[model samples]
Target: MRGNFITLEGGEGAGKSTQAGLLAAWLREQGTEVVETREPGGTPGADAIRALLLEDDVPLTATAEAHLFAAARADHVENLIRPALAEGKWVICDRFIDSTLAYQGAAGKMGVDTVRAINASAIGDTWPDLTLLLRTDGDTGTRRAIARDGAEIDRFTNREFAFHRAVAEAFDEFAATEPDRFAVIDGRNDIETVAQEIRSIVTERLK
Candidate 1:
């Protein structure tokens, strides 16, 4: 059986990581061989590249930085995600191409065309069957991030309020354009509520 691919997406403080973990655990309770991964890192070597991507003081140009991220994603896709899927496991990705589009394309103002081209080249239409976009307000997201992450904020996590707003708006627009593949869920809700929303989407679609 071909495996199911589910990619979770959202802005910085949208609670995607938390939800991903929760969903993975829930699936394991049902006896599924779920492989949870995330962009900018997954495998060993890919994780090394991820450090460069998320680290501050790198000083790379926007386009160059985007290229590196895409390369890392490509590597992760080939070495980790695909193999896991072929083994009939659920591949739950924390973030995928939408992140690039929102962060670099919309928030960084690097143009969607470029971001899409790179994303296409990297992921090559091998998109997730479903994408859960966790939606949250900028202020709420910022507070959540500050509260949860303590002092170790990555480069992307350390953006200004306007930048997060742009990211959230971009994701919202992207989901709107691709209604068939996306589901926008409120991240402000409690964990079980958010998980229920996500569970409903998956059960509905996969059923």
Candidate 2:
């Protein structure tokens, strides 16, 4: 049997990493073999690319940035993700193609269709079986991110409030369009409550 693929997505500080960890742990306790990973850095090559993409000093155009992300995803999918899934491991990812679509396609100057086209060859049929879209207000998310990262914010995290709001809106629009693929979660609640909500959704879907 093929293992399930689940991706967690949202703007910065939406607690995707936390939920991904919790989900993986719960799935493991259920006797599922879980592979917990994050985008842009799952493998060695991808990790180097991730560093370039996130560094504050790396200057890249919107189109260039989007392509970089696609390249990283390609390497990550080919190297780590595909093999794990082939072995029947539940791969829980912190982010995936949807992040590129939201950040570069919808929020950035590249547009959604263009970003999708760039990623088509890379992702192919490896899209997530379920994407947990964690929703939080931009301001609140930013506050959380700032509290977590402090002065060490990355390039994406340093973007203006308006830009972050646009990213959040784009995620909402994408989830609205792909209801079958996405499960929206209110991320403003306590961590335990959010984890329970996600666990319930995952349990229902895995059945």
Candidate 3:
């Protein structure tokens, strides 16, 4: 069986990472094999690019950053995600192309169409079969992120509130436009509640 690919997307602190882990575990409990991973650092090469894109102090142009993300994703899909799926292992990714679309395309001012075009060549037909868009208010998400990461925040997380809001709005617009591909979930609830919702969605999709 060709394995399913699922991507979790949301604003910072939406608990995508946690939910992804929970979903993968639940899938395993049902005797399904799962490959749990994340972006933009899923593979070794991609991890290097992730550090450059996230940690380097030098400011990269929006277009440059988008290209970096594409490059990292290219490596990740080729080296890890694609192989895992080919072997009949469901792949649960914390973030994926949708993040690039929301952050680099919409919020980064590059345009979603352009970012999508750029990434098309990178990952080819590796788009997720399902994307769970975790929804949470900007203030609450930001507070959660700050609390989780403490004083140290990633480059994207350090952006102004307005930027984060734009990212959230972009995710919403994308979900609305592609309702079949996206399942939006309330992310403000406790972790167990959110996890249950995600698991249910994934289970239904599998059926």
How many residue pairs collide in each prediction? Answer: 0, 0, 0
In candidate 3, what are the lDDT values of residues 7-81, reduced to their tens digit? 999998999988998898889999999999999988999999988888747688889989999999999999899
Candidate 1 residue lDDT tens string, 1-207: 868899999876788988999888888887888999988799887799888887877766668777877888888888888888888999999998888888888888899888888877677757888999999977678767877836458787787889888888898898899999999999989989999888889888863
Q: What local lDDT score does residue 198 receive in model 1, on the 0 to 100 scale?
A: 89
Query: Model 3 reaches what TM-score against the true structure?
Result: 0.96
What does candidate 2's lDDT look like per residue over 22-118, in tens digits? Answer: 8888888888899999987899989999999999888888898899999999999999888899998999999999999988888786889999999
Question: Once superposed on the true structure, which residue ranges of model 1 sit more than 4 Å away at CA?
Answer: 149-151
RMSD of each: 1.3, 1.1, 1.2
Error of 3 at 127 (Å): 0.9
Compared with the true structure, the alpha-carbon lDDT of candidate 1 equals 0.85
Flag clash pairs in model 1.
none
Worst 10 residues of 3 by lDDT: 149-158
Q: Each model's TM-score?
A: 0.95, 0.97, 0.96
Q: What is the lDDT of residue 9 in candidate 1?
A: 91
Clash number for candidate 2: 0
Candidate of highest lDDT = 2
Model with the higher TM-score, candidate 1 or 2: 2
